[model samples]
Target: MLRPVTRYADDLSYVHHTGFADLARGAARFVVDLIGPERRRVVDLGCGSGIVLRALTDAGHEAIGVDLSPAMLALAKRTAPRARLLQGSLYRVPLPSTDLILAIGEPLNYLEPDARPPALAAFFRKVARALPRGGRFLFDVIVDAPGRPLSRRAWAAGEDWAVLVDTTEDAARTRLTRDVTSFVRRGRRWRRTRELHHVRVLRTVDLRRLLRDAGFAVRVRTSYGEHPLAERRRAFLCTKR
Candidate 1:
């Protein structure tokens, strides 16, 4: 069975942080720019392995990273040692009082979105509650779009590890499921691991409306600053009124 929304495990987290951190790295500049020169408390929701957190701290922000994965947070410790890190769901964790909240890599799309309003209205409201007037939220989500194919397969490799992902969209269910397999060099041999992840395919219109109702002024974008996002995905730059 495909896994429901949950914290990433050891192998996948390792592979992702090591081999596929570029997107987060690129988004970091855009994130840092948005915060300006003033010191602000920034909370990274689902911070993964802290590529962005590193950038945030390096730019002089008070940074806090929250993730449900111990493995990922462990990596964050090395990447941004000066930042405070916590382990918990973005939806359940106590968001540190912050001027910015970031959920990059479309973390909210993996919420196992059941029957509540899109954008997970309650969670958006919680974020709104945590922010003061003019607080910012930078995040992205995979959405049903004009040219998204029904299935996709890709692979990435580093000097010591490699990963393959096969993904399929279930339009009827409004979700996408990914089967991830990884190989890590342990000695003379490579160890293999596999897992599945599911993400809901969000509707952009619904997301915008929900965010607006949650008290955010939302701007939809197809890129992070000048760094282009993958097709069928969108970033939401939201500000609390």
Candidate 2:
């Protein structure tokens, strides 16, 4: 077998789009409300499969989406045809000047470069430079909280696709790993794809300090408003002030 890809592929993206859709669907209302009826330019980093892009466009925002996975961007194109979809990493992408930036789904956590706090600190500076005073940087980060599980296995299935994931969290090292295998039905045959994802457990305190250093006023919350994110995932609303 080939070495597991580090990012989402076709089958894996499809599985997530179909099976874990509650994450995107549940986030729609709360995120939209954060837009506050303004027709602002919104850039979505790691805009997977475009569910939130569709929501942003439907709400009249000029939405630009960036992701490293072409497979995920393909689905996102169909999901939000009106939104401009760019294939690029959030860490390396040329982010456009925008009134608001959305990095929902913990997009900042999974990329390998973010293994260090300085990488994320540089990213925050970039985001700060890409926005003007009063602009918003709304995103979430996964923290290594106390009493969290060390390792876990989970699975999700749909009519034509299934996903199995083995997750390992190391608190001492501040890392999270997911070994994911996806099986998708293709013309009466099942195709399997595997990918490994790693997330750095960047602390909220460090991230808040970085945001503040980058000229943002940061607030941490468990939810956007009504939609409580999965455990340990905390949202940050950073306004350039």
Candidate 3:
């Protein structure tokens, strides 16, 4: 059986300090500018908790989000009751014409190797099928250089857990190896769970190639937020043909 593409059982508040809401809003504004004001129809692929969806809507765009996790979509609905939210995979989203598609938060890197290409292909086909002559897709990805020392690392406070961080050899992939350490709580209980993920490290070259194959003219810019594209993290700007 295939693994469900979405997972949102835990509280997303864990990653709150990552500034998901602010970052998504900034990215949305950038996409709208690149795609133009007239094209206001947008979709948020892998929209977690509908943060990006909320951001897009606040910017006066007709934005909806599609996520694989029903739990996450439920949270999203609670967060943005007016925004249209869908529970589905990126590989299979049912919708009509859209002017812009945004997928951020390094969501693309979470796909397994074999599932990566096909997922991208399907998403591209959907976007192309929906878009007119000049539409755009903006997404972000993380790159990992295997065997490299940790650049930025942090632990979830109040838990005896350490999050191991490393990028794969290709510099396009990253893995968040969760190292679970146990500590007694109130001298009564213990908690532990190890979450290891082997996700794709999408490379710029391969990503561009895939976009071209999917009928997109790709332009790799450092994020619109002015972050430099390095061996770790960055964003891509793609215009569908």
User: Candidate 2, after superposition: displacement of residue 73 in Å?
Assistant: 0.5
**Per-residue lDDT for 17-134 in model 3, tens only?**
2333556656655765665545387888888777767766666778788877676777778776768988777767676678877787766766542334346666667777777777
TM-scores of all predicted structures:
0.94, 0.93, 0.73
Writing each residue's lDDT as its tens digit, candidate 2 over 1-241 gives 4443347889988888888877677666777887788698989898899998899899998999998889999999899999998887788888889998888888887755333333887899999999999998989878865556647998888899988899998848487788898999999999997888877777787888889999999988888677788888888989999
Look at candidate 1 and give me any clashing residue pairs: none
Off by over 4 Å in 1: 1-5, 112-119
- Residue 155's lDDT within candidate 2 is 89
Candidate 1: residue 53 lDDT (0-100): 94
On lDDT, the candidate that comes out on top is 1
In model 2, the worst 10-residue window by lDDT is 109-118
Number of clashing residue pairs, candidate 2: 0
Provide the global lDDT of candidate 3 against the true structure: 0.61
